[model samples]
Structures are given as structure tokens and as C-alpha cells.
Target: MARYPTITEIAQKLGISHSTVSRALNDHPRISSETKQRVQDLAQQLGYQVNSSAHAFNKGESKTIGVIVPDLSIHFFAKVVRGIQTVLDQHGYCTLLFDTSEKMESEANAVSKCIAHRVDGVLAAISMETTSFEHFLKLSKHEVPLVFYDRVANFIPVPKVISNDYQAAFDATMHLINSGCTQIAHITASINLNNSNNRLYGYLDALKSAGMEIDEELIHYYHLQPDSIDTFIENLLTSHPHLDGIFVFNDYAANYTVNVLQKLGKRVPNDVSVMGFSDEPVATHMTPRLSTMKQAGDKMGHLAAQKILAIIQKQEPMEDEKIVINPELILRESTR
Candidate 1:
């Protein structure tokens, strides 16, 4: 492995004072631009990793941000991270990733670590189990700008970048209704999540508008798993007994629904109709291609980066906007 050079070693090699090399490494305004460029070029050649811990302690700028996500294996969160990386990489910022795996304690610990590291900002997709906002509030006390993307805490007053969940669900439900699906059923996440509530509201709104009675029993809410969900699906079809259309709140859940439907000898769109949110890559390739609400995950992630960066820079007073990106409803074999 090639040895990395420290500032002191670089200064000795270039026959310059350590202070001069330090100033040049930081591109201090006092240093001549030509000298700064020369130092940077040589540092790049020598593969110098600026000791961010030491530099941030001295200058108070970490030049990095922390991202806390509920789960990285999900396509939606992964795409959100990709979007965040695109923006951060362009702005010369690095990211520290923390996966909470939907655990409340893990999310809390991740927030503290981000604060201890003195990240310039934080972009978080809060875990589903997070009910208290105190963990996030700690970041504010330390003056760390925070932005929420996708799943978020409703009580927190921060710039949020999210898809129009309510509207997206409404649109998906409306699409199913238009496709002659009258007896519709909804499979949603636990109601504690703001996103889940929004989706549920949308589904209800569409059903009400169509003059269909909201059958409380037709709505299924549970933690996601394979075997557990299979039981839910069986109960859903057996108890209600009249479900022609089904709206799953997320793509992953919808995929599982299709799997269960197949095992139960139900043909998608022919025997029943289905729709899901967040047009994950697999939605298109399902046996009966899934109709889904397409959220702009990349757009939300990039916008979160921009807003957090702006907050860190203390840019001119602008309205704290709740950016709700509209979703697209894609029709496919599942909802034909």
C-alpha cells in the first residue's frame, strides 16, 4: 500500500514551513492563489487525507455530512442515498452513513454520533419506530442543520423533502377505481409513521370521493415480514371476501403481496388488481408488471442536500418550504 503523507512530511519534501503548508492545504484567503494551487496539486499526488477530526476541531468546519437511514437494503432509501451522494460529491462534501434497521435505539445512537463528529449537516430518513423527536432536537441544540427525507417526524420543524404521499396514494387509488376496481383493499404500514398516515388518508379520500363506504376491516396494518404478511394476505382475502383491488403503501410490500397472491392461486389484474408506491426497479419486471406511484427519490435527496447546505452556509432568509414533489402513476399489467 502507498504511504499517505501528512502536512509536516509534505512541507519537508517541498522545503516550506509547516504553517505555510497548513494554510495552503486549507486554501486560506491570505495565501496566494498560485501557492494554494501548487500545494493542492502536490497533496493530491502524495495522496494526503486531511485529518478531518483535527481540522474540524481547529476551524469548526467538518466539510462532511451524516446520513441516517432506516434501512439501506430497500430500493427507495438506496436511491435517496444515491441522489444525496450526487449532490454532496459535487459540492465537495463526504457522507457518513448510519443504518438504523428500523430500530428506535439504533436511530438515537446514530444521531448522537453524528453530533459528536460535528457534521456540517444531517439528512435523515427517520426509522419507523421513532415516536419521540428528542434525538433530533439534540442536533438543533448543537446548531447542526437537519433535513428530513421520505419517512419523517411530523412534529419536527425542519425543511422536509418528501414525495406527495397523500396525493400519490389518492392518485393510485383513483387509478384502480377507474380501472373498474370497486371493492378495493389497502395494505399499509403501522400508523405511527407520518408517511403511512398520509398514504392512508389518500386512500380514504379517494374511496370517499367515489362514494364507496370506507370499510375499516378492509384496511390491513402490520409490521412487514414474509410469513407474517402471508397470514395477513390470507386474512385480508378471507375476511373481507370481496377485494377486487388492493393498494399497498410501498413497492416492497406490494412485491410481497404479489408473491402471496401467486401462492394462493390468484392471478394479478385478471383475478385481482394491485398497485404500490415508489416505483422500485422490480416493479416493472414482476410477472404481472406492477402499477405503482413513482416518487422522485433522487430529486428529494438532491433537494435535501441543497437545503441543508444552504442552512449551513447561513444563506439569506428564505421561507422554510415543505417541498412536496408530485408522484407519477404508472399503469401496468397488475392494474389493467
Candidate 2:
């Protein structure tokens, strides 16, 4: 492969020392303006690009941020990534992405690889099964700032950019209740996740406030694969025939559940109402447009990127300033 023009090569071509070339490229005061301009113009002509890898070898960081997400197939993560890239690009920083495939081991290994690459910092959304945080300490030990978004490991003392989950869930459940849904059921993800736990509490709290009984049978929690989701939802509806409303973990699952309910002869918003979290594209595109809690994925992504930059630039650890973007409920055809 052809190599990019180097500083030494530029200096040799211009009959100057490499140090002079470096000074000129950096716009150092010692280098005359004429000399700097001449060298820069020549460098541009040669298609010269700064070697971030070489810089990291000599001065620690590669000026690149590592972003880890559970999976890229999900559109929400892709939207977040677009937002991160927008902010990172403005600051002349590059992003390195790693998809953990929602596995705990894969997440740990991804962090290790990022550390090995000498990234300036890390922004992550932890895996579903991740519990042990010892793997993330490598960045802290090396003084590379780490920031989390969406699904976070709160035990780690890092600032996070997250949606206002509790309030969103509360409002969503209350919406269902106000819509006259008396038998509401919740399909949850792993209870270990803070957001999942908060959503559960929110659902129960709404029930308490509505003068309703918090039935344990009304809530189902699991970490099933995509293929099994339909079966699970089918079983859920079959067992709980009285459930008039369902609040799902995400929009994809909610969509699947709606399809399953339709197969079982249950009409959405008539026989049953459905609400989902993270209002992705499917919400608007689905047969009965979904009612959902709109998490600002793009905003969360931008904030996570900015958080890492602030922490690394300041040479400080995570602080109390956890930025929380409030989620909005989008009422649609899925709910009456």
C-alpha cells in the first residue's frame, strides 16, 4: 500500500531539517510566517496527513474515542453513533466503534482491545448481561476517560448521559391507566439494569397511584433472543387473557408483541393497548403506529461524546453532573 507523505520527507524535499518541518507544520512562533506557509502549502500538495498512531506512540493518546454499544443492528444505537460522530468530527477527533453483540465477555474484550489501541477516551452502552466491571478498570488505570450512555454500569464512577427513565415509565403507565386500561402487563428486560429496575418501579408506582392492585402475574421479565420473542408474547397473552394493556422494554419487542396479539385475535387499542420505549422508526412505520416514550438517542450520543472530551481535557474523573435528557411520550394508534 502507498504511504502518506511524512514530515521528514517534506523536510528533505524542501532542503530543511525535520525539526524545522515539524515547527512549521505546528505553526510554532519560532518558524517564520513565510517558512510556515511555504511548508504547509507543499505538505498539502504532497497529500500529507498527520499520523495519529505515531503521535500516540510518542505522547500517549491517538486523539480517537472508542465507542462501544450492545449491537449496531438496532437503529437507536446507530442514531446515537451519528450524534457522537457529529460532535467528535467538529472537534477534529475520530471515533472507533465496537459492537459487543450484547454479550458480557464480548463487552469486556472490546474494552481491552480499545485500551490496547491507546484511545484518548471511551464512550459506552454496557451489555445486557454485564455485571462484573473489573474489565473497565483498565481505562481508569491508564487515565483514559470513560463515559457511558443509555444502559450504564452505575457502580463505575463515570458520568452518564441517560434518558429520564423513571419519569418516562411512570408517565407511560399513567397514560395507559388514563386510557382505561385496568389489566396492564409489563414485559421487562434484565432487572440488573438500572433503567429496567427504574421502569419496573415506575410501573408499580403508577398502579399504586391509580388505586389498583400491583399483581405480580402482570409483569414478565426475560432476556430472550429475537426468534423466541413472538412465542414469549404469545404465551404471555394466552396465559393472561384479562390483560388489556402491555408496556414493553423497547419498540422492537412491542412491535413483535402486537403482531403476536393480532395472531391471537386481539385487536390493538381495542382489545389491548401497547406502549414501548425508545421511539425508533418502527413506531411510526408499524401497522398501528406505536405509542412510545421518545428517548433522545442523538442527544444522548452527543452528550456522551462531550462528556468524554471534558473529562479527558480536564484530567478529572466522573463528577456529579450526570446529564439526563427527559423522554417524551408520543401518543399514537397503539393506545386508546
Q: What is the C-alpha lDDT of each candidate?
A: 0.86, 0.88
What's model 2's overall lDDT? Answer: 0.88
- By lDDT, the best candidate is 2
Instruction: Provide C-alpha RMSD values for all models, in order.
Output: 3.5, 2.7
How many clashes in candidate 2?
0
Model 1 scores a TM of: 0.88
Lowest lDDT 10-mer window, candidate 2? 224-233
How much lDDT does candidate 1 score?
0.86
Q: Write the per-residue lDDT of candidate 1 for residues 36-134, one digit (tens) a residue.
A: 887888899988988866766687788889999999998888888999999999987899999999988999999999988889889998787888879
After the best TM-score superposition of candidate 1, give how far the Cα of residue 160 lies from its true spot, in angstroms.
0.7
Task: Give residue 319's lDDT in candidate 2 (0 to 100).
Answer: 68
Candidate 2 residue-wise lDDT, 1-336, digit = tens: 988899989999999999999999988999999999989999999999888678766875687899999989889999999999999999878988999988989999989988888888899888888888888887889887888898888878888888888889999999999999998989888876888888999999999999999888777776746556666667667787788999988898899889888988989989999999999999999989999999888998988988888787885556645689999999999999
Kindly give the number of clashing pairs for every candidate: 0, 0
| Structural RMSD, model 1 | 3.5
